[model samples]
Target: MSNPTVSRIELWHFGAPLPEPFWPSWIPGYPMTENRCTMIRIVDSDGVEGWSAGPELIRERRGLGDVVGLMLGQDATDIDLAQQRLREVGYFGWKNWWIEPAFWDMAGHRAGQPVWRLLGATEGGEVEAYASFGEVRSGSQRIADAEARYEEGFRTVKIRVHEDEDADIRQVTEVAAAVGDKLRIGVDANQAWRVSAFADAPQWDLDRAKRFADVCADIGIAWLEEPLPMDAYDDQAALNEYSRIPISGAELHTGGEPELRMMIERGCYSIYQPDAIFTGGIDQTRRIIAYCKEKGVTYTPHTWTNGVGFAVNLQLYTLSDRDKPLEFPLEQPSWIPECRDAMITEPFIARDGKVQIPEGPGLGVTVSQEALAQYGEQFFVADA
Candidate 1:
């Protein structure tokens, strides 16, 4: 009758190879050939396994076992305790928020309800999906891609733009013309977490962001995301006030509720996109969602990490009262659903540009043992 306690934990470093190299606009010039993540499986005393994953470029979490040991034997359904434990782990300079969802998964299984329901959703249903392109491609290619997405029934599409101001404006203009009124467009500057290690990445100032926002408004952009750095609260607030279109960001912001609350108070953005994995997990993200609702700000999560990350956010997105479509990370050949979700039994494929909510309990994620054996290496295991 008591809550199930954590009994065992296992971790794997998975690298699912892509069919082709993926050029992510955020981390310019880096050729990502694998969908890499640190996969965690937590089994409660009741023998129900909960799963979660964190994005990784390497086995950097080799020492995570020592940290995760903090949760062994704790109440699996006590998310507050789990969150506190994760925060303690962070004090050691490690952001392990991504692992907190595994506890929610366990609680859902124990209660015989999906995670979304556990989080207060009245019912389960499909959510509209926007095709989120990961690369900044040529104008012609981007137009073709938008056309293809329209054919696939995606009424909304988000495109990436980086570097040169003129080139970025041109790309958005061309794609807008190609799709016209057929698809609503969102533009991501990828300026929140700028990566210039491999190649030069442009850093946007207030002047540039204002100019871009004007252009986006003229071209009918639905939103402009991350126009300034994540911490630029003052500038972001000014830009949000100055722009005609909505401004959104905070996807990977690690400052948790306090930081997000400050942004909300400052009117930093009209829309807040906090990915559960990066933004202090589900519990904290839910708090942010409530704040956004109270402050009249739009709340839609960023779900570009991977299948498991997507599943975690999907469960949380169902809690939102807004009708915005979820961000469906879909770049061609390299970052398609097959490769993105290779570790899970089912890939989230959008049909008519909408993905049905998973009905199963515990995050609705079923890890594929076969795929795990093929694409993952077991690196850590512990028992209570």
Candidate 2:
């Protein structure tokens, strides 16, 4: 039989409320609301435990207990196998990709190492960050907001553009005109991805994306992110060939490397953004970065989900090229460090618009037990 000391896995829901409804303008018609949290707990054969979590809409995970407990006793070192088993759970109802990262954490502790070192990267990188705006305001308001953000120590920005093409162009042009050479600019159509909650969300086909690309080109935009539907592989490939600036997408793709392989072969995005949490686990993302570098395609990690998700993406971001700017999500009051990252003992803060990668164990970010008590609800746990 296998060594079986810590023989179960637990999934907990941490019910917390957002200060206000942080309505994403990109979502078109979804109303504002609070955030419910879900944290993943994994136990090793030695009883050493690890945790990871994501932002949840509702505190409803009824069947995760069945999947996690049985997943124990298998070789945690085998990441590929772990992913496969997670897929097996899809036969039921849950999407178990979140569990895959915990396996890496367990494997790291077992090897007496950190996850970054386990992934074949050397030193951690000091990443330059872009102030990515979550709310897409009216054109006049957007310009004022962009200026305000610049005053807040941001040298670069990526704004949401899901409105009419002409209006978006005018707004972007004004923002660029005001910032002049003072800032680097990027626009996200928020089209490639949309949330179908209770309201209608706009969709961007290839024709619309191409038309928008023309405006981005005229106004000296840096790069456009997620312009077309993410899986419109052929459409993205065609856009890259004809666009002025680089076309980037695949933040929430099924398999980015395989898609990236096709993109590179067909010449898609000049830059590739794959969130380690939302995409796949670190190993798959790890491969995508190397592949991008070898083929001269830029790679940057999207770190906007939660503190742990941000931390995980940050470690990966540091290992990638410094030339590739990192996305540090900072929409304050409702979505700032104190709240969006309230659970993390020490949330990420930018020093002159840059973040330093820690040389500590694991992902180098700490979680606060006090904050956990205030915000986290322990739903399940495994014995020692």
Index of the highest-lDDT prediction: 1
List, residue by residue over 41-133, the lDDT tens digit for candidate 1.
999998988999999977899889888987899998889999999999999686989998998888888888999998898778889999999
RMSD of 1: 1.0
Q: Write one digit per residue (lDDT tens) for candidate 2, span 1-384.
A: 764343557766765456766767566776445545688877777765566776576766655675666666776566777777766776666455556777766766666666788777787656688888777766677677667777877788888877767777777888878774788888888776677675777788888888889988888889998888877778888888889898887777645456656766677688888877766677677878888888888888877777788877876776677786788886655667666777778878877788877666666666678877886777776543
Candidate 2 wrong stretches, greater than 4 Å: 1-6, 91-94, 110-112, 382-384
Q: What C-alpha lDDT values do all the predictions have?
A: 0.92, 0.73
- What's the TM-score of every candidate structure? 0.98, 0.91
- As a TM-score, model 1 comes out at 0.98
The positional error of residue 323 in candidate 2, measured at the CA in angstroms, is 1.1
Candidate RMSDs in Å, in order, are 1.0, 2.5
Q: Pick the candidate with the highest TM-score.
A: 1
